[model samples]
Target: MAKVSINLATGSIQKEEIIVGIDLGTTNSLVAFINPDKNPQVINDTGKGVLVPSVVHFGPAGEITVGNEAREYLVTDPQNTVFSVKRLLGRSYHDIENYKDFFSYKVIDDDSESLVKIKVGDKFYTPIELSSLILKELKARAEHALKTPVNRAVITVPAYFNDSQRQATRDAGKLAGLDVLRIVNEPTAASLAYGIGLNPEETKTIAVYDLGGGTFDVSILQIQNGIFEVLATNGNTFLGGDDFDSAIVDYWIEKNQLNKADIIADNKLAQKLRLKAEEAKRAFAYQSLVNDKIGDIWCTLDRNTFEQLILGKVQETITCCQNALKDAKIEVGQIDEVIMVGGSTRTALVKKMVAEFFGRPVHDEVNPDEVVALGAAIQADVLAGNRSDILLLDVTPLSLGIETMGGLMDVIIPRNSKVPTKAGRQYTTSIDGQVNMKIAVYQGERDLIKENRKLAEFDLKGIPSMPAGFPKVDINFLLNADGILKIQAIELRSGVKQEVEVKPTYGITDDQVEQMLLDSITHAKDDVSQRMLIEARVEGEQMVKQVEGFLRKNSDFVSIAEIADTTKYIDKLNAALTSGDKDAIHKAIDELNEFTRPFAERLMDQAISHAMKGKSIE
Candidate 1:
């Protein structure tokens, strides 16, 4: 850690810091501290602008200013003042494909793996490290502004950050030497900012559509009394106002017929034009044409041009909204108020779209950009155990499941099921004479296991071998109130158990989860669709094979006619599996399980009777 120095006529050294609430965002950041009455307040630097741009500039002398002071340097030092690096935070290089268009800076490619390295100096830094730099600056800002030691703070992150990304944020806080009280979700915090102030009569279903500098999130919540339950959340971690800026930049750059080579060669022109375009994009939300001058560059940007450039991107947000509604299983008309958060949502086009979609006005009182920070501070207050009445119950955004017989996803905890919810799913051996079964846990909304993010794996090997498919194994998934996942499993027959303790992995695990995956090289291409087909076929094959093996092993135990009926169903499944026809295999599986009903019933009856005998004596 370095000290902030001041030169008074000649030279000086003053060390001080203060605890703060920081919004470590993609484009901007701010430091907030408690006032005399312990109310959270932003530590404004004389001018009274509470919000700080998360950009940083490295001068020839290595000096830095976080907000407006650093902002002026964007046009001056075009190569420095890293903006929107939050887009790269906790994200993989592969995930970047869906988001790279939002950034104006060039992405430095990594040759080794899926890690993304951005070109900064004659150097490159990982997004986590870069994020730490921004976080450290916030720490220093609060410290220098308050003249007290800043040792603790709370930070906000996108709601959808998987396990790895969440960990990265925590790591960033730690690297900066601040005790990150909790990593609260950006939109969730905004909702808290709005909901905590309302009365019991103010019960309403609020949807938060936050489009910040480099991220977009839509959260549907039911705030009754004081209980804030998040029903559903969906968003592209990369969608935001930054993309809108890029759209304007792309339009202007293309209109002038410039290429990467031309822009890189003329750094000042590029920076000047980008800043102008971004300002125009922001201004178009209020006025039709934003006329501005950047150095010698003059431009009058209009709403029509901005709209035309971003119609597709804007539509993508609509698609995200639709999917979020679907995930929540609610209609637009059911929403009470559309609370818009983030600087980008101030756009007239975005407002019109939201109003048209929900037939309601937006909660315009709370400043979109500042609301999250305020909400975060409130949550920090609660986590500090100050606000006892307010308890936040958030859901794990994705479903969690185990890999079944084949590579198919067998979901235990469905999406939006509620926090601290536990689900148990029983599995049977796919093969006869099998003593051990391995459970691979995953999380995601995808239908296939490969498509989902693998959380962890546990193996139960002490089960007794009867024949093939004799043991019953139950997998239990426990998602706590904070949206973190925990899992455990036990073999019913032998009581053999294994519990999976999920670790704090990098990128918040998902990058949608990077480490949860078995191998990037193995399933990156046919991850989802292929896994579904294979799983279906394997299930059918396992069912059919087990039935045949059962009949052969216990020839005289069952009637010939009964065996023949089950055998016919097994034959259908076997043939379908061999032909690689998923539909037929699925149908055959149902039919085969149906034919085994009587024997299954008998087995259940016998077990019940045998267990009741002990209870009678007691």
Candidate 2:
């Protein structure tokens, strides 16, 4: 029994290949698909739990494990076990500098601009690689359960994930050997699960409040003519049920008068307490009181106390909901539906507060944990050409970008973005007196241009000579209805402009595109490494030029000793750049910046004093 039909657009019979929907969650991930009966179903074949813990572990001998098997390593092998890799997706060491202590594993901090890497034993793994392991496990599970090769999927992400993060996710999927057909927003997918936007003739506005582990997002969406448009989205990427668990742990720690560091340092005790806190959180949902103990430590919590402990966090989410509504230019009364999605929504307090805020009954009919995956299945069905009632608008199948610093792919138009769209970002020259900027257009998801499909290269010449990072250039990508891309580069300060139009898909077969995507995934790690090295070299050269210029201009203001110390550091940096060690060059740069700080401050003070000499008092 299968829902098979012909796609009139292509005049070909569509085969039911069982494309799936995957909810790649931070805490837990799951897969679902539309069944033969045309109903969305979560696959939990042969008692394999519907929720797969998003955890991975590496052994002493480099053996790999994922999901439930890996969850055990959270306590036993905290350093080798990787959890919440989702948070590290497309993030740099600097992005999570403040939250480094939150993870027990080592997140390498060598470069701030390069993508994060987790060190397990002696091997380095990027977030993209770690996530691919999880996705691969999911893929294996699906193929085993469905008895078919599942190679295509629609994955869900937070609505606010920027272009880089989204591309990183798509690359992860590709690495997992799945063609990610679409990257659907979690809120939008959750809405689809509840059948809010399925009617082609109906129109409605809804609020989707998603609170999951390690993240919270509230998105206000307008569904019209079967198009789900996100009006506004607001929430903290770091605030969610994980915070609630921490609150519970802190409550117990304070009551027990135990040393906090003692627990975090002791991985077994930390994991035990974390598990107990999670149990207590779930128990309080049904029972008024819950008690638990791990050895000498006692953990107890009542519903009232637990609610009070997490009330502030809950209130924060409510405020985000209000802010989302405000940004959408809608009142609470304007929301036709309030849909709640996420395992955290199962908490009575969360549901009650969300209801109280919107002044309406919340939609919790579907399992919050499975809703996103189910909705994703429905979307997959639509993509499979099984549903004519749903309208899939035209979207760019691949991201288009221009080569940037270090030959990195700076995405100008991300994949799946609607057609007839225009987007732009401001960039600056990396070297002083750079008169010509080479813009090489490429199409793909990898971070480096070598892994992507290079379409064309051009030069924007006649730029005004200025100090490094002084000339502001605006780069824009405009995609028209005919599927042609128009890229425009303008130097606002110099009034120099250039434009190019390229048909991104011209003369390229689908098979060639697939090969390009495959190559990107196959070489992602190498490409990223090369990109980092090039970026380090570029940065080192720029720093050298800038320091030399600064010393020449400010020699009279700076002390001879300061100039000598800076010159020594600059020479060291120049030497390190030739060594091809990004870490060493960065270290030299930091040292130089530290040494010049005082001199730069004094110069700024002198300039301000001179400028104020003839100024009237306010």
* Among all candidates shown, the one with the greatest lDDT: 2
Candidate 2 achieves a global lDDT of 0.85
What clash count goes with each model?
A: 25, 0
Off by over 4 Å in 2: 1-14, 45-48, 110-114, 254-266, 405-409, 444-456, 492-495, 509-618
Give the TM-score (vs. native) of candidate 2: 0.82
**Alpha-carbon TM-score of each model against the true structure:** 0.57, 0.82
Q: What Cα-based lDDT does every candidate model obtain?
A: 0.67, 0.85
lDDT for each residue of candidate 2 in 1-618, tens digit (9 for 90 to 100): 866655342344546667999999999999998876689998785576999999999988889999988998887778999999999998887999989998989887743365677767655677887998999989988877776778889999988887668877887887787878888989889988988899999899999999998889999999999888899999988898988899999999999999999887887788788878998999876689988788988898899999999999999999999899989999999999998888899999999999999999999999999999999999999888899887877888788988887678877787777788898877888777899999899998777777778888889999999986789899999999999999899999989999999999988888877787666656655665666677768767877887799899889997888888888998899898999776676667666767777777799999999999988997
Compose the digit string of candidate 1's lDDT tens values, residues 144-241: 66656676677888777665576567656656666565676776677767754335446777788888777787888887766566788888766777
Relative to the true structure, candidate 2 has a C-alpha RMSD (angstroms) of 5.7
* Local error of candidate 2 at residue 591 (angstroms): 12
* TM-score of predicted structure 1: 0.57
